[model samples]
Target: MDYHIYLAGEIHSDWRDQLRASLKEKPGVHFHFYGPQENHDLSDAIGEHVLGEQPNAVYKDLQASKINNLRTELHLKKADLVIALFGEKFKQWNTATDAATAIALGKPTIVIRPESLHHPLKELSEKANVTVDTIEQAAQVIDYIFA
Candidate 1:
């Protein structure tokens, strides 16, 4: 079955572009990207690209409070998976909260941190199924998991 993967990442950073490109390459994969819409602008470009062509695929924009509700609804309505991009800094409440939620849900969480930065997640990184330094590495993990 096709998996619905939610991408969590820094909106303004280049990581967003990388994530979008990786998801686009994987045709059958559905993704729900949760992040700050104002800074990320994901809905305008990447989100539209993914959903525009693939009618079967789905993507949802959600606030932190809505994530669990959306996930539960989506999972019940269809099979799903969660792919989280654990970017640098736990400063943002939403990023940290989303990561925690994904982990708590027992979804297949993949944490991506830049090689330069040490893994910022104290206990949460331990829960992530895989941790990688780059988007390429994360994409490989996704390919492996979804393959």
Candidate 2:
């Protein structure tokens, strides 16, 4: 079965590259890299490695009323799991939103936090199906979910 995984992390952070590499080894997994559009080209990177498909911009326009609708629709249409990268930052709104949405939708969700971070992703960690602190641990979570 195909798994659509939503990748949550700080834009422009090195973690995105690591995530891309990790997911590349898991062939059938498709990723939707979510974050502020200006800071990074995560979607493009994922597209290059996977199917070269991008999210629908017409649907993702950020007007307050439409953004959540678009996100929900995308989740319904494309996601089976949500993988959040909680790096140096404790947690960001987008990460919270993605994890919450995934939980509400009954999708399997994992939150990965770097141990170096000062604060924990307490709320997300509490809700996540699994939580880890390293790329290796994250890969193990993926293996568990996809195996």
Candidate 3:
């Protein structure tokens, strides 16, 4: 079996890398990952790089997020599953948006976030197929999928 997974959410950490490594190889199983730019610099400046500078921060962010959505939508549609992280430090509303889109597209979703966010994210988590508080726990789910 083969799986296409989308890793979305806060970019303030390298949890994606950890998740990728944690997935041990299963016989006859393969995994493909798709997501936003991992490099913070490029990810943050993509709009300015592609569309030139905006007049202000709000305009800049608007343009960047719009551009980024193109890739996010494409991958979400192709993915068999989506695992999103909602970190404590950054207010990554984009993570919520991507998870919602994944659910809308009928993709199985695993939400990985801190316990501190549980209450506020309850509604969204209720929609997810599963929710865990760590990348390792999320990896365990993927292992179960391909097992």
Best by TM-score: 3
lDDT of model 1 at position 58: 40
Residue-pair clashes per prediction, in order, are 0, 0, 0
TM-score of 3: 0.91
Best by lDDT: 3
**Candidate 2, lDDT over the whole model:** 0.62
Candidate 3 lDDT, 1-147, residue by residue in tens: 778999988777788889999998898988889987777787778899999999998988888888788879999999999999998888888899999999999999999988999999999999999999999999999888788
Residues 1-147, model 2: lDDT tens digits = 455666765665677567667753556655555533433344324333344333565323333324444644575446676777766654466666667777788878878876665254676687788888886688777776666
Runs in model 3 deviating more than 4 A are none
Compute each candidate's TM-score over C-alphas.
0.59, 0.63, 0.91
Q: Which clashing pairs does model 2 show? A: none
As for candidate 1, its clashing pairs are none
For candidate 1, the lDDT comes to 0.58
Candidate 2, residue 118: lDDT: 27
